[model samples]
Target: MSLARTFVGFSSTDINYYRLMTAWKANTNIDFDFVDCQLQNSINSENEVYIKKLCRERIGMASKFIQLIGQDTRHKYKYVRWEAEVAIEKGCTIIGVNLNAARKMEQDTCPPILRDIGAIFIPFSPYIIKYAIENYSMGPEDWYYYGNEIYKGLGYE
Candidate 1:
């Protein structure tokens, strides 16, 4: 089977984790072709219009969006937030992965928009990641909202 097209949204400080994920993908059976949306080159002189256009286009092509939450992630909103907003608008399945070392004690520390939209937050586990990617439904109504909490329709606990 072909791998799912995934877009990874993260802070620049977490670049090493992204690199590790890439290496893991290369060495393991993770079934997703990851696209690193974090800008590496200097965009100092580039036009904002062009940058946004390029990012939106790349995110548009992805079927799944993974936001790696780190300590600095909640404070860095420029690229990560923009990428996630575009992904949500494009109907990509959003999965928030809490870095093992940076896991926050409060759920409210999660990106506000992601939490408001009821995105599933999971620990950094390869099996859970694969399961989330494979089982996430694309329809809007597939998400479950109960009382004050949003539960993933796939019965994640």
Candidate 2:
């Protein structure tokens, strides 16, 4: 059987993604990577090409794109928008998160723009995220997961 793909995006300010990611890593092995929104400033034009190329590489390899549907991820950052878009354009199935369960403050998941872009919103609780990561090849989670590994990937620790 072929493996299912899921690319997760998030709001820059949503600290919850980190915490929840910790829970997810503890629970399962998702074999995931992340794109950093805050560090795009230092990237030069040469790096930009490499980045976009990487986006293509990632989307090309992926079977689904998981959007975290954070407050600003879709609008504030250009790279993320491009990543999601390229992922979609590359025929990677798009999976949007149901923010109702992951976040507690504001309501709803999958922003209007994401909806306009044609992403499928999957209702996901923490437990569900864990389960999905484990069994994604079987059925496909194609949605949200908290990711603490981001900081580590960025050399934060």
- lDDT per residue as tens, model 2, 3-121: 34545555556547745754554554643333322222333566777867755665676666666666565454566677766766776555555555442112343444455443445
Q: Flag regions of model 2 displaced more than 4 Å.
A: 1-3, 15-19, 28-46, 100-113, 116-118, 130-157
Candidate 1: how many backbone clashes?
0
| 10 residues in a row with least lDDT, candidate 1 | 142-151
Which candidate should be chosen as best, given lDDT against the real structure?
A: 1
Clashes of each: 0, 3
